[model samples]
Target: YMHRPAFVALLVVLIIGGTSVGTSAKKAYNYRMRERDVGKSDIVWNNDEYVLLKNGDINKAYKKIEDELGIKALKISVVPLEMKYDRLEIREGIATIKFLFNGQLLCFIQAKNDIASSNNVVSDRKVNSEIYNIWLDKQITIERNKLSDDQIEYSMYLSINGAYYYLYGIMEEKEFEDIVSELRF
Candidate 1:
């Protein structure tokens, strides 16, 4: 009789443990599927002057920024601003998203402005290095400055009708260039 009770208890414990494991596995699988669906979606904002393009995983993007910068106060918020040409009203200021790829830190900035006004804002004066071409034959002016004995900062500026973008980070030179090449800007 005692053996029978012990056996029943073991079976009950096994059943409960199996149910818990299965539930956890299912939850993980669902989370991955959700992430995949988000990655396949496109987020865009279009107007007469320009279009802003972003991935559907905006929350994930913000999370990346928080993780990379170790900042907890950053929240997704819109700022109102006035543009120079056409008196274009900007409802958003800038979006800063960071990601880590192949052990490199990449920061992406997305902003929108009138094409006419954006043209006037492009200047190579701040860039410390020679200009190079990237996506769509667009010129990328780079500036690198030493921040400390072991660290360096890089800034890349590019303007397109879709958006006015800036990427700045402290990383390896080759990795920075690689990330710039992948930008959709």
Candidate 2:
């Protein structure tokens, strides 16, 4: 009869663990919904897969990065106005993030939040942003590689706020120039 109590205890433990996992998952879902709603923009989240956005409201994505890094994150000023996406995903790395706008691959941004981990590559091309960002390295440099007929990949090295940021993306020439030139705080 004493063995029966041990079996009951085991069952209780399993039940409790399952309930705890369910509760935490629910909490995460609720929190994501709240944050999405608070944006008050046209960002639509059907599930955890991808966030479909017509207006391209990226507040949640950039805000999350900033909150985690404790530093301001970069935002794209010039965006494709005709974009209509249906899925959303945030692929994360050690200190990197690649986000899809609802369904399409937008860009890849890696924030080297560590000062010592900054990229040491010498500036290949002079980068001048009339707009000054405090977090930007004064001697920021950039390089470009043509990936395909239509896709041009650009990598911009930024040393800022005692950290470094590597911005990488493949876009049209005009789009890339507009993004790099129009970057703001």
Candidate 3:
């Protein structure tokens, strides 16, 4: 009787140990999958609030973003803004969106008048190029002056991802810093 009891107890210990190991492995797998899913679904930048010219289809992305934000289709006429450095094609109006973090977001949608036309069809390449150039010039300036150096003089830095989509216009360093600071994400 004593021997049998001991044998049963030993068997129970081995079973419990095996079950514990299996459960631990299963838990680990579950945790890893959850983390991966979160990473895959991460939203890096805002589309509607910010002027995002993504690598994907610009019109499709713009439409979807516009609908999501409940914003109307932006009809713009480009206005030539004479700056100290160069003449820039500025969007006639500025759209302000109250974003999280007590921050105000400013989006400039180029007006039709501001953009030059070749044959009445708006040239996307031209627009993209103009924006990109402007973004680059601004980035260089921002890099030269660190944020800690002057908070008042801080210029917005254009999101690198956004700049990639519109790579044509000349950007002042001050403008790039200003844009980057405005971005929430």
Predicted candidate 1 versus true structure: per-residue lDDT over 11-91, tens digit per residue: 999999999999987765452112223465633323311212233344455555444433331222321121111111122
- What are the lDDT figures for the candidates, one per model? 0.50, 0.53, 0.32
Tens digit per residue, CA lDDT, model 2, 106-182: 44353545544534555344442333334343433456765557454666766557545566555554555566655
Ten-residue stretch with the least lDDT total in model 1:
79-88
Clashes of each: 0, 6, 36
Per-candidate TM equals 0.42, 0.48, 0.20
Name the candidate that leads on lDDT: 2
Give the higher-lDDT candidate: 1 or 3.
1
Global local distance difference test of model 3? 0.32
Count steric clashes of candidate 2: 6
What's model 1's lDDT at 165? 64
Tens-digit lDDT string for candidate 3 (96-157): 22111113122333222223432132332211111223323432222222234342222222
